[model samples]
Target chain A: MASVYIPTPLRKFTNNTAKVEIQASNVDEVLSNLVSQFPDMKKHLYTSDGKIPSFINIFVDDEDIRNLQEGATDLSDRSVVSIVPAIAGGVDFSKEELARYNRHIIIPEFGMEAQRKLKASKVLVIGSGGLGSPMLLYLAAAGIGTIGIVDFDVVDDSNLQRQVLYGVKEVGTPKVESAKKRLTELNPHITIKTYNEMFTSANALDIVKEYDIVADGTDNFQTRYLVNDACVLLGKPNVYASIFQFEGQVSVFNYLDENGERGPNYRDLYAYPPPPGLVPSCAEGGVLGVLPGIIGSIQALEVIKVASGVGDVLSGRFFTFDALTFQTRTLNFRKNPNNPISGEKPTITGLIDYEEFCGLKAEKQVKEITADELHQWMIEGRDFQLIDVREPYEYDIVNIGAELIPLSDLPYETDKISKDKKVVVHCKMGGRSKKGIMELEAKFGFDNLYNLKGGVIEYVSNYDPEASIY
Target chain B: MPVSNVSPDCKEVRFEIASRDFLVAERLAEKDNLELTGIYHTHLIDSAYPSETDRMSAFPNFSYLIISLPNLRFSEMRFWRLNSNNQFEEEVFEILN
Candidate 1:
């Protein structure tokens, strides 16, 4: 009989005993001896492919049996074998977990080592809903070492469609607790840390720093921006995946490689925040139940790839999936010159009030109309004077029946223009119009000057498509 | 590294420098002989100067080409020919229609 020392986590596999004696010779024989006696321990120890589960490290005396002889390691009489789960309360495959992860262990490209890394990794999942549900479950099942979840919401009946982490019994319980219970049951070998509160800017940096990578499964913009800024400030890798009804976007941001070359952050792609209310949340628009499964799976893949240091990590690139057309598009975003991130570090030190930054909180200003409305006004012979504040080349292309007074030449044209008349200023795409408005208001002191929204792009839409005035 | 040989394909012969790039250039140069010359890489957002990292890391035995990306445009290309003294002399290469 060979005596095996079972660690704290794996002691449950050995009837909560620190040591168990089983009759066997080789490592395979030893496992078979234990399995025959316990019957229930087979699924806990061996993967579906008949190899040892990755999270459990077996050592003979002093040598890790994985590097020594694997499952084929021979055992002598009175030989000391240790079965220790790599993490404390970390992700461990129970017999059921081993069965569920059989397919992964069998794949040679991933095999045992990848699973071991998963078990040793500490991944903090930001939300326990939709995308977070699958992401957490898969990471747990994969045998990740420590899984920390930050969520304050309670499990709602509506969350059952996609949040596989919680179920009917967990309806009113807090999401973090419910998820913790389920994950612990799924694999008692994993350490499940739960924070029953929303992630805020004050705690974001500290919380994110503890884990190697943060999976942002958040649902709103405020949290998303806060998390992004915090990740950038703390220099943690943010594995970002967002879903909107039928579509999803995934990208990796803010982590340096071993060589000290900093990878791209979120601001490298999106320089500005999305206009509020323009982008609807998954709650309002509704997502296909299976969509999060696809996206969350990919997010898990990115986490594994990043943790393992094997595959090409998606940094500064967005992989977008469109369920409507069944097409996947990859948009490569290069580092923007005006990117709030400077030289591999974030330029925006702290999170700004994004609602204010996005003009969501700004009071409505003077009225504005579409190009079609302007055209209709012209057809009705309105008395307002139209002014073009575009560059010479832009004005040379197209102008909506306006007097050409380039922004640079605005001071020269100011004397000839009447401040009493209501002046409508426009440019190619409205950028120059804002500049013109500033110049006119601040420098020229023209109180009546108004900037056109969406500029000439709106104006050209009203013209006949067949006619070519050019 | 600077350009050792010059070949003209209406004023642009891809500049080749590094060992890997030289092998590629040599093979392409053999096939396209007279039309190909040296290769060039643009250093964008850096000074009109070469950095210490660039100078120390680069092979000094061969000539090198450095084009600042800040100055690069569709109409004009600025060429810096490095001398034996490690000093760069400017040569303007203009694209003619």
Candidate 2:
């Protein structure tokens, strides 16, 4: 007698019984008897070609039955034929989707399989900024099955310059909500999930693990590094891009090759970050308005290629572009032996303080005061100086009766700031004011500066909804 | 299966069992020469009568027993099933000695 032990997955077919003793002398007889007792188990145990598939391993007495003479393997009275389903369907596209992707299907190299793979892919885009705007537009247009957007910033008139995902109506609204509204209007078929929160170390892994791949559109170096480490640790490919004044760089990081070997990651290219103030941000060093659109489209193409095995993914190759001279270059880079994440002797295990690693002082370097707190202070007749570090045009639109000293003119007008009193500085939103505080503290050695948290936008949104907000 | 309060409705909760688990339950029932006939649940705020949501989400041809606990001192039990027109029709019951 041979005992067939059914795993949990196939137990339903066996009337929820774990083991069934069969009167069989060989491996084939044991399987046939088990299937005979439960007729539904035949298709689960055998392929259409009447052969056992590789995924389902058949073992007898801790030995592979295939190691013996296949079906003729002898089974003793004490033999246990274990049917184990180890740890770990047709999604046909609608007629409209088929028509939309007819161009892709027409290509012999890029056919229905690639289209299906694309429709099954779930890509998480980190930021809804300049790059995110164009990339998400194309992603939705192409009908990626699921797209996740992570952004916390509210839309402003400044974003309309390059952030094609929003309009005047979306101003003062969360970027994710705005992007979702725009992308949905573009293609209602694909699913778009919004994370109206910062993608920090605490929630980075939680969010990235849900998506099949990540297309990083984050602007800051802190988030760029965070995206890289999360993708590497999760063994997911990162479709990466970064844009400067008129130049942009694109590369696919931590990608697995056909042989299941990992390609060079972000650390392999630039092992360490440049000093905090060394590389100015896109906000400070303006991006050529159309640079992200061009680069972001390329990024979307790489993401689609990675999701669907259609063409050669830009995994090992780094592409750079300069709009001034219209120059384009593609260079090859390899894994660095000195890399900390993936090296002969690895050091870092999990995500660490990216701000400190980038040589920026950990956050809270600049003291901040919220609008509600400031309003309470004003009501109590608290003695404090409020400085508006915004352009005169913005101050003209609306102001909380603070002296206007544009950021460009802050250095020349430092004498106007009160040294004895606690100084609260603010701009359109909290970002520029934070930079203004950091600049004054570093250059002029002023210690009494406090950035107005969320700046005028928060003040108007929560405290004074009637007030005009940029 | 026990119910949870994750759903939007605070007054009621239903265990949305997976089809796989339902299939397993059916198979287990068949092994003992029985069948899955019905489900019973509780309503905290409303009476034992079926709510509109309950009728819309109900599976056909199964007796549904709803026990209402409107207050700490009183309790009521009623039986129901969906008719051919997909309306909840109350079923009369008897107590055995």
Most accurate candidate by TM-score: 2
**Model-by-model DockQ, in order:** 0.01, 0.01
- Residue A404 accuracy (lDDT) in model 2: 90
Residue pairs that clash (backbone atoms under 3 angstroms), model 2: none
lDDT of 2 at A203: 96
State residue A135's C-alpha deviation in candidate 1, in Å: 0.5
Clashes of each: 22, 0
Mind giving the per-residue lDDT tens digits that candidate 1 earns over A96-200? 544566676557577545665676688889988988999988888777789899999999999999988888999999999999988888877779899998797
lDDT of 1 by residue, B13-96 (tens): 122222223333433544664222333455432323433333432322222345544335432244554455765555556559
- Candidate 1 Cα misplacement greater than 4 A, ranges: A1-106, A343-347, A354-470, B1-97
Give all candidates' CA lDDT scores.
0.70, 0.82
Per-residue alpha-carbon lDDT of candidate 2 for residues A338-407, written as tens digits (9 for 90 to 100): 8898877778789988878887875656898989898998899989999998889999877889989998
Q: Over the stretch B1-97, how does candidate 2's per-residue lDDT look in tens digits?
A: 4433332222223334333344345447558976556666665534577755567556555677878665443579999887869898999988697
